[model samples]
Target chain A: MRYDIRFSGSGGQGIITAGILLAQAAAIKAGKNAVQSQSYGPEARGGASKAEVIISDDEINYPKIISPDIVISLTQEAYNKYAVDLKDEAVIIVDNTLVHEYKQDGHKVYAVPITASVKELLGSAVSANIATLGVVNEICKIMEHQWLLDVVISNFPERAAENNTKAYNLGIDLAKKVME
Target chain B: MEKKRERKFLQGNDAVALGALYAGCKFYAGYPITPSTEVAERLAAWLPKNGGRFIQMEDEISAMAAVIGASLAGKKSLTATSGPGMSLKLENLGYGYMAEVPCVVLNVMRGGPSTGTPTGPGQADIMQARWGTHGDHPCIALTPSTVYEQFSQTVRAFNLAEKYRMPVIILSDEIIGHMREAIEVPLEGELEVIEREKPACAIDEYKPYDNSVLVPKMASFGQGYRYHVTGLNHDEYGFPTNSAKLIGLQEERLIKKVEENYDDIVQVEHFMCEDAEHIIFAFGSSARASKDAVLNLRKKGVKAGLLKPLTIWPFPDREISEYASKVKDITVVELSVGQSVREVSRAAGGRCNIKHIYKVDSKPISPVDIEKAVEG
Candidate 1:
């Protein structure tokens, strides 16, 4: 089975990093084939950025996503730009605090306070990406929760690891509530 | 004891940098450009730590010249750039060819003409790689699609340059350069690394431009073997020669070295072509889409196959000609408007119909694109 996931947000929001971590969890921890790619303007920040990750049981030939199976957007602009042409059954999770507008066109759409929750808990929205990863994994069940968390911990520095861990667990809880 | 191969998730440009280190490349001189800048960045951090030299040259021309100079001084050198930078390096690249300096030039191609798209991918440099430099000079270029091939082909690029005694170009695009994938990094001593043949004769008897052998033994500039190195056509003794016979022989020998060892220099991957009637001819990242198209077509019971050239230059004429005779038609897919298709047409020689599916809008051609072209 092939699953293509896209993460969209403004640059410097770690959208690409979230995509990479998910790919790493699948490829390295779960022993699956995965490919991750990103597209962005030539800016360090504030421009639209999107990253796509393909996880598969078989060899991946075409690297880019033809149609994403899951879409995660942190900003309304990013949501409107990439949420189009998604698969009919595609799962979309958008940040409720930042993205207030989205089409719920016969697809599973969850608007969670992703950035606000992280900011409330950790005093900053820096770990919103990790929280989003947690929410996506909980909803998709793509890999073992511990495997994904392990990959996430390995990516960040030591001092920031604790807060990121809290953010991830918070995301899982948020996602479970949404499913409930 | 079997050595362990470490698998790591690496970007394509980072893989190229690591591959260069594995191939014993000790000098890197490059000017930064998008899509290809990561190569220089990684080398800048790693090259010095590994006891190698890295220089961020002021401009692309100087970077190319510095690489050629470093290689002439007995170091395996490399330079990375995109399209405009590639254009700037062509003049010095030709010098590397004429002077027989062994170095690698990697073009992680971005969109074309003159700074067309700084961050987008393009294969327009396909023709430029083959005939970018002036004159009847021979070229060896490799196009790798996967991150693994990016690493392996880069090592191969260095080996080809050192073995052939000329500049080798790696035509990678932004997608392949920036994309990240898991790859099994070869263990040390696992891959064959070829060093340039050093002079075995007396210092005075060494001929920098020796035609007695297809590839003459090279001596380091400071190794007490003094010889002239110039872009001008010179004789065996490395002296400027106006003699028509010597100049003619010089050019022929330059071309003959690559042509004589064609099999050793050219590589291609044939997927599902055993009994296939239709073929998709592609290279670089476009080949990845072609592979997907072939598989999808096969599912629908169509006889479609993929012929991907890992070695882009020294065009795989022999392979194309043979496939043209076997296949009903071949569709060439590239990111450029139409660069490699002309070569595909020339190599097919009308034995099979040649079609083209190309894109220049900075977006990669998808499998659907290739499938539509083949079916239509």
Candidate 2:
């Protein structure tokens, strides 16, 4: 079955980059086919950024995100903007720190204290994006945790690698228990 | 040695795609539209299987934009559309013309100023093909009268596009588009296909838009050759400028490239005009009726002949003038009320009487109409 995953947040959050890493893992690492497309307005930053990734074993015809199976929102702006478009069976994952009380009626919600966890683990909230990437991997089970960790190491430059690794592991451990 | 073969049964749109593929077109970007969708469908299925790429954009504007983008990435790109879609693509076509990007745009014209007749054909876009896009930029338009010419002229379209570094339009109407006829696609390396000339000078000495050769050298985007391109009037460096002299020189250079090379770009077909007293100016499917009309008029002792355009733009102005001046009466027939008739009138120059036999009911001009026009 084809699964469409979308990562939506403000432009600086690396939400689109998270989508790209997932697509690359599915397409290049696992030998499956994937297509990733992102939408950002004319603004350089601080605007909404959304990246849609579709993974399938067969050729993909339609690339647009109609109803994503997994919708991850790192901010309140993204959650409120895209929550209504989710599939009935979709799992809506939101950051508890950025999105305090927003919830959808029929969809299951997984609230992770992503910003607070990243700040406590990595000594900064800047690694919240990497922490969310780990949460996404744990919930989707599309890629192994170790493979995602390797993806993070290879993706980030040398100086910031340790902080990202610490934040990512903390997110994976938190999502493991929260999803249960 | 094997036999040299040329036969015919193919639709004009398919022939155009075949010609483009044979000319090494590795990329095609287009949105599907009626009467022209087959070209995109065929390319979408064929290009990817052949190691090329195909993209269907959200609209014709994006389709044309992606085509220009792909061309900048060093792929020989093309797009096909009918009337409404072609209208949507004009803005991008202007950008392509101003940037001097080499590409081909096939307009398989249907009846319209709007969505007139989706399935029926018309040669009405003749004027639009020349001046549809804004500004005084030069354009090369080829009108193929037969499916065989559709294949051959498509190759010519690519050659002219690459040679002049401009978007060349292959204007095939519904008649040629839908009409299926047998056509032999020559083997690869048989047809002469001319690619764009690359820079011969050293990197430091090269100017991407240099007027020295009248044909500037182009470097593809990924080729490490740095160049800037914008739709504004600019100097040799491809920077935007408002200088009148630069604008004037660039405009003249654009026209001179096509005008001076019209001998290589313009094509026409003449039938039984030797000592004929009357002539009918026609193109696209209308020319088919004009051909038979000439036969009928000859049977009636009218001494009439047909002048069919294979090269619609550059208008065959001088050739039409020389040929029409020899005839006493010339009747211009088209699916439109009267568009190409203006060109025929100007070419005839009042030295010969001009008559316009028009049909705007979205039907092909019948030979009887041409005969009636000549008799009147």
Candidate 3:
């Protein structure tokens, strides 16, 4: 079976990077077929940007996320824009600190204060997408933690690897706490 | 292979550069154009390390000329550009075609007539890649629907160009060029690389345009062979000759060189066409979506199938013809508003109903669009 996921956020929130990481980790590191694609306005940032990733064991014919089985919305705009299109039992992930208003739309909603936690743990809000890399990994479990961590950290500078790791671990812990 | 294979998540453009490198492409002269700029970027970074040459030309015209010049000087050369740049490069491209210059021109397509959409995707260049150049000339163009195919087809492009002693176009689209996919990079020396045939005879007897044979043995510039290479119709020694008989022979030989090898040059992938009632004709990125639509239609008891052409310029007429005759109807899917559909209709020869599932707003032709066409 194919698993479709969308990671949505304002541009420069690293949503594209996260989607690339997921697809790369699944395809290159884990030896699967994966496709990641996105479309956004010509804006440099702050637009309703979104990245979609589809991973399957077999050849992926339709490379788009078909009725996203999992959605990761890092901004209010992203959440509001995409939440309505989730699959019947889709797992919806959102940054609780950013997406304040969300109607329970049949899909299970997992809210984490991703921005707040990333800022506290990593001392930077820019890496909030990296932190949610951990949250999405924990919630979706599409790839192993170590592979996903490697894929995410490798995209960043070598100097910031330790803080990103700490933030990711914190995200995993926060996800566990929310589940309980 | 002494070197181990390297696996990486790479865009198709990256693979195109690497593929040229594998095919012994020693020179790249290209302008930066969207969807295809990464090809120049990757070659810039990798070519120096591999002892190859990369030059950013002032424009696509010079880029195409530079590639031809470098190839004439005995280097495996290439240049890549997109739609508008391709339009600019066509004159020089036809020059290379006429001169029988072996080089690769990668056209990573985007919407265009005149800078239509910089960031959007389009297969509008399908016919352009084949007929953009003003004259009737034989050229090879290959399209890859996947990243792996991009690498393989890029290598094939260089091989065919050298083998045919003519220009080859790698007609990649924006979606394939920019999309990242995991591919196992072939080890150095793992793939078969074909270089141009150097003259076996003495330098005194070498002729740049020898219509005596199908593909004349080219003597690279400064190879101690005194010969002329020109865009004008040239005689056996490559001197410009307006002789009616000789010019006609040169033109016919150029076309014959490719047309005679039609079976070898034409390539297509037939997916579940044995019992297919509906055959969908597509190439490049559109074929990916069509493949899925075929599968879905099969599940719905439609017996749908896909005929994907990897070698697009030669048009794969034979395979398309055979299938079009048997299938109840044929649907041509493309990002452009009916460029390839016309070719499919012509190749089908009214044997079957030819439908077009075309998109021209620069949006990708989704499977639903193709599926709807099949249903209709």
Candidate 4:
């Protein structure tokens, strides 16, 4: 099975880091083939930035996503840009607090208050990328939950670890509640 | 006993730095550019920790000069840059060629003629890599299609440079340079690392440009064997010689060394070509998509195959000609407007029909793109 996932947001939002962490969980932790790549404008921040990950049981030949099976959009601009042209059954997880407008288009759309909830619970929305990963895993089950958690913890410093963990768990809970 | 290897998720640029370290690279001098900057970044942090030297030169020209200088000083040296920086380093790159300074110059290509797209991919540098420095000099360039090859081929690039005593180029695109994948980095002693041969003769008998042998033994500056290194045509004694015969001989030896060693220096990958009637000629990132297209074509019973040249410069003319003799058609796929297609036409020698799929919009050619071109 192959899963093509794209994370889109403004620069400095850690969208690229989220995609990398997902790929790391698949390749290093789950022992599967994975490739992660990103593209951003010249601007260091505020530009539309995107990171893509392809996870596969077989060897992945084409590194880029031909048609995304899953997309996580943290901004309305990103949503408007990437959330279209996806597979008919593609799953989309958008930050409801930030992405105010989106087209459902028969695809599974989980509009969760990702950034707002993280800010309310952890006093900062910096961990919203990690929370998005949690929501993605809950919806897609691309890898084991523990594998992703381990990979996420390894990426953060000791001080930020607890908050990121809380954000991740909060994402899973948000996805669970939305699915219900 | 088999050596233990470590597996980790590595970006292509990071892998190149690690491969250089594994191959005993001790010095890095480069002006960082997009797509290739990670290579310099990794080497900058790692080289000092490993008793090596790293310098962020004022510009690309100085960076190339510093690498040549470091290599002449008996250190395995390297520098990485993208298209624009590569253009700046060409003059010194030519100097390295004329002076026979062994160093690795990596060009992680981006869309270009003049800063076309700083963060996008392009293969237009294939020809630039061959003729970018000018003159009738021979070139050695390696193109890696995957992150693993980025590591292994970088080690090979250093090996080829040290063994051949020339400036070897690694032609990577933005995709391969930045893409991250899992790779098993070779343990030390697993991969053969070639160090330049030291002079075996007495100090008095030493000639830095000794043409008696295919490759002369090099002595470091401080090692007491003094010699003149210049871009000018020089005689066997390393001094500028106006003698026509000496200049002719000097040029002949430089070209002949690589030409005679073509078998050893050239590397190409042939996939499902045994009975293929149509072949896709590609390299670097385009080869990845072509491989997928070939597999997809095979499933549909189309006789499509892929010829990926790992060694881009010595241009696998002989191999392509052999395939062209039997193939009905050859389609050259690249991410540039059109670069490798010219080489493909020359190599095919009109034995078969040649088609090309070129994309210069700073976007990669997808597998679907290749499949559509082939199926149509």
Could you give candidate 3's per-residue lDDT for residues A104-148 as a string of tens digits? 667688989999988876678977877888898888788789998
Encode model 3's per-residue lDDT on B1-376: one tens digit a residue: 3676778898788889878888888999999988789999999999999989899989889999999999999999999889999999999989999989999999889886898787678898888888889989886789899988889999999899899988998888888888888888987667788878988788888877888899988888888888888899989998999899999999999999999998888889999888998999988889999999998888889999999999987888888789877989999998877788888888899999999888888778878778989999
Among the numbered candidates, top lDDT falls to 1
Question: Against the true structure, what is each candidate's TM-score?
Answer: 0.98, 0.66, 0.95, 0.98
Estimate, for each residue in B257-366, the C-alpha lDDT of model 1 and write its tens digit.
89999999999999998888999998888999999999999999889999999998899999999999988899999998888899999999999999999998989999
lDDT of 1 at B115: 84
TM-score of 4: 0.98
The regions of model 4 sitting more than 4 angstroms off are B1-3
Can you write out model 2's per-residue Cα lDDT over B195-279, one digit (the tens) per residue?
Answer: 7777657677768888666888888887767778899898888888898988888888888888898788888888888878888
Model 4 agreement with the true structure over B235-259: per-residue lDDT tens digits: 8878999999989888999999899
lDDT of model 4, residue B232: 95
Q: Best to worst by DockQ, what's the order?
A: 4, 1, 3, 2
* Candidate 1 clashing pairs, residues 3+ apart or interchain: none
Off by over 4 Å in 1: none
Question: Of the pair 2 and 3, which is ahead by DockQ?
Answer: 3
lDDT of 2 at A1: 68
**Candidate 3 chain A: 10-residue stretch with minimal lDDT:** A36-45
Any idea what lDDT model 1 has?
0.93
**Worst 10-residue stretch by lDDT in candidate 2 chain B?**
B3-12
lDDT of 3 at A101: 88
Best candidate, DockQ: 4
